[model samples]
Target: MTHSVKPRARAADKRRRLTIEAARVLHEQGVERTTLADIARAADVPVGNVYYYFKTKDELVLAALSEHSAHLDELTGRLDQLPDPRDRLEGLIRAWVDQRDVAARYGCPTGTLAVELDKRADGTLDTEAGTVIRRLLDWTGHQFRALGLPDPEDLAVTLISAYQGMSLLANALRDPDLMARQGDRLLHWLDSLQSPDPTA
Candidate 1:
């Protein structure tokens, strides 16, 4: 196979590389304690260069959230291969929990940013997370419809809400054991959804 790179592609590559390095910094430190100068130092790039790619700290945080959401998108993409709504829903629950687990292992930046969002209502970083989460739930609902569930949208909402609730609960408990238990029970609910009729 032969390949060619366009100028736009090259520019995107540079930005991606910078964003990736920044993500590592954010994961290690945190959004509140992190500064563009710190990321520039870590990335071995000039502060001006970091500013060239991202105009503000909020934009950089949004990029980190984008990176996290991209991980979710990749897992959800696998549902196309499952071919069973029941299996897909179960897989979705497991995948989402694992996403949280992995993010938790890395200090759970998504959850951290969410708390920041609440503290500063008009911070605007919420826009990216809100959109990404909605997209994830929308995709999950589509799978629910395929499984013959009634009101797939409502079911998706419930599942998403449950997952978010468990995430917050796990953060509070800080116990991996409880997280795994809640994850199993969450998937069990999805399994129950495979019935001919689902109430609520």
Candidate 2:
């Protein structure tokens, strides 16, 4: 029984490593250009082992997408622990700011993958890729709603759009400062949202 469990654990670890490496390769090279061999090399697993874990490239891509979604959930779950909704929102922006260099180099992992998959004619991969953004949107919207905002969903969209736009510009321009500056502006915007309306 112990030996069987050990092998199962090792297999699970290898599978997870493959998915993680796949996500990294996909983020760096885009989905169309990434091959199973690339992922296997990056994960330091045998190419045949990759086949054992994922029968095809699409299955591996799907696993990578799930990995991204799980990461996003963990991040948002951490942010959700903050006592203040505004603080939570600001924390989200700060996370982007912290990752600005990576975003500038490779673009937002989730964003880039989603955009690339969205171009495919089949539409299946696009749906899977979208779950990451949907989770982000839902979490952000929940923060806005908690703050008693009238247009929580709209506010969430606005914030996420700003981040995505900044990411695109930073990556296109290869300017990490652009993301940092955007983060400052977004932090100010969050503060503005919390300000008491003069009309009130």
Candidate 3:
């Protein structure tokens, strides 16, 4: 008999599974150690089939990173609905901490992959990750700017930087309590930003 093509539904499902498994393997073993064969074995597909979903390991990483960024975009969008800038900042900080706690408890595939991808100065993954981050920051800054603060962008950077640093620290300590405490401190600092600057 002549060859026949698989249905599109099955192909889409396979690609979804491949992306999920690729994230898991990358999280456990890091990008370098996660061979396409490893992903195929974990996904229970032919070794050559990994290329069907992802042309390369880098594509897999970009997909995983995109997945993680979606999590932030959805959550942060809700934070934007709150009109009070200070409250929005506080809520956003806590939300971010909570997300990190859950991800850390679950092995944090995206964060794990980020460690390696971040080191590369030039790569598709790096470029995409940067875009995600800058957008998050800019959106965050918009929330503060809405409050009519004189330097909302400056305050926004301060808030985002605090969240980023505390995430890694809490992940290392594996302590949700620490994250909460640190997040509270950051929120308090954001509140202080609302006051007019010395020159203003």
- Best candidate, lDDT-wise? 2
Ranking by lDDT: 2, 1, 3
Model 1 agreement with the true structure over 1-200: per-residue lDDT tens digits: 12456756766776787687677787667777889998888767778888878999888887878887876678777776887877877887676566665444543455556666656657667666677777877887898888777899998898877777776666666655556787899877776665474565
TM-score of each: 0.78, 0.96, 0.76
Candidate 1 Cα lDDT to native? 0.73
Instruction: Quote the lDDT for 134 in model 2.
Output: 85
Best by TM-score: 2
Segments in model 2 whose C-alpha atoms lie over 4 Å from true places: 195-200
lDDT per residue (tens digit) for residues 87-172 in model 3: 77778777766676654453344444655787866654766766766777788788777767777778677776676666666667
Candidate 2 structure quality by residue, lDDT tens digits, 19-113: 89988899999989998999999999999898898999999889889889888888888988899999999899999999999999999898999
Q: Sort the candidates on TM-score, descending order.
A: 2, 1, 3
RMSD of every prediction: 4.2, 1.7, 4.3
Against the true structure, candidate 2 reaches a TM-score of: 0.96
